[model samples]
Target: MRDEKWTARIEAGVEGLTKAEWAPDSRNILCFSEWGLRVTIWSLSTGTATYIQFPKHPDRGYAFRKDGRYFVLAERYKSKDMMGVYDCPSGYKLIRHFALPTTSLASISLSPTGNHVAAWEAASEFKVVIMNLTGQHIATFIPTDDPLLGVRHILWHPSGTYLLVGGWDSKLYILSSLEWKVVATIQLASRLPSSTACCTIHSS
Candidate 1:
């Protein structure tokens, strides 16, 4: 198996580095840089690249929705306590701006279904908030303890029934959409024998 994987990698040389995300159709890959503030689309088959100058901002992050129709572009200001989102392919249409109750935006994640967004803020405390695509606050889930680990990543289950949050503390949290409660928590390093050690939800 290792030998076969290596052979495929050599044949695919420099092909995968052109962009950060491959198009839903697998024809192109979308790429961007936080420092350069530029967005580029690269053709996977032809190796051609097209670049677009991104709007000026101190910090920027983007997520491509599953349908490939639009992208969520988040911008953080240098001196302001707010963040903004742009709805694309309409590019830079101010969807909504929210004032940070804290100091900075810790991280942002868009659900796979494209209906919701999750954002974490880090300041003297840690907080996570969920919002709808229209920028309305849907629900807010705050852990009792600071999780001591900041939110490193957030992902939505394909069924859109749950959100998985991974933190620097080496823990994974599975949250239910309907109840908005933590259904399960898996510790990073635990040798305990339990059925809840692994959590899996089937989406039909």
Candidate 2:
């Protein structure tokens, strides 16, 4: 019964899977809920799953390395922002933990090269913090002073030389990776409070 037989099944214990992302190697699955309080990763080869819980989070603040060797997250500790990097396969060891200056940090984006991570405020105009995987703070890009300046998304260019930061201000700031300066700004008609492929464009 080649056509009728079940090929495989995964018993992910997550009750409500709000979002799921596969590791670059396709050997692991990461699932999150709408609440953003917990995440579970299942190892396909080992048939085991591991979960990480958070005290609070404004958005899904985690990303897997391109090689799937480790994962990084914006974790909260005692009402403070902290970055945590965990090892793969086992997923229990906390290899690194770095304290961040702002508690409102959310929406994490690891650079394409997996060297730096960019995290921004979820509902405020706090500084966009950029740091390396070793927990060293590289730089911080300030948000607009306008009241409408809420960070919506932080995306690193494919070349990892610029960061495209957009938000409720209906504008995008292209920050040069070399100096972390705003190289250019693109204004849109509507509030850019979400990530979309159409809005992800390279700077000239």
Candidate 3:
């Protein structure tokens, strides 16, 4: 990475901008407008722009596939939480859109291998739904027997072997990629997920 003076400038929307980040390709900038309204993507190469509505969360509600070819974002549509997958290189077209099975959907992420997506509900419910590219439900994982207090975060390992999930209940759940089952559960200190990063287990 090199530091260089940039000349490109993107003007904000009528509602003004909340946050902006470069797309995986490094040529496009995704600008999120205020109040979770819409995301305006400005392409530097093509000098073109595109927009998508109802981005659920500015930061964690969207993720790009590892290859940077497919883009997915969580949305709030007609009082329902939805997920939309877009084709980044194909003029940012809407390739797939469907409603997610959750009331308060917090975050949605594409797996490292690009074979599936993992999404979870916020609040006390320990509901994490796994689905394929076509919006087919592969599995639903509930780590605890009873409901948890809150879901802090969920991330897929870069190797695509394990999915790390944690919550306010102060526990971390490691799920195997094979069946999406809870392979191991680890207890944590009062200060949690932020401090826990990589966990290695030699034996399953």
Q: All candidates' lDDT scores?
A: 0.62, 0.76, 0.86
- lDDT (tens digit, per residue) of candidate 3 on 18-52: 89999988899999998888999999987888999
**TM-score, one value per model:** 0.59, 0.76, 0.86
Lowest summed lDDT window (length 10), candidate 3: 191-200
Model 3 misplacement above 4 A:
1-6, 191-204
Rank the candidate models, highest TM-score first. Answer: 3, 2, 1
Given candidate 1, what's the lDDT at residue 7? 16
Clashing pairs in 2: none
RMSD of each: 10.0, 7.2, 7.3
In model 1, how large is the Cα lDDT of residue 109? 76
Ranking by lDDT: 3, 2, 1
Q: Which 10 residues in a row give candidate 2 its minimum summed lDDT? A: 5-14
Whose lDDT is higher: candidate 1's or candidate 3's? 3
Candidate 2 global lDDT = 0.76
The alpha-carbon lDDT assigned to residue 71 of candidate 3 equals 91
Assess candidate 3 and give its lDDT: 0.86
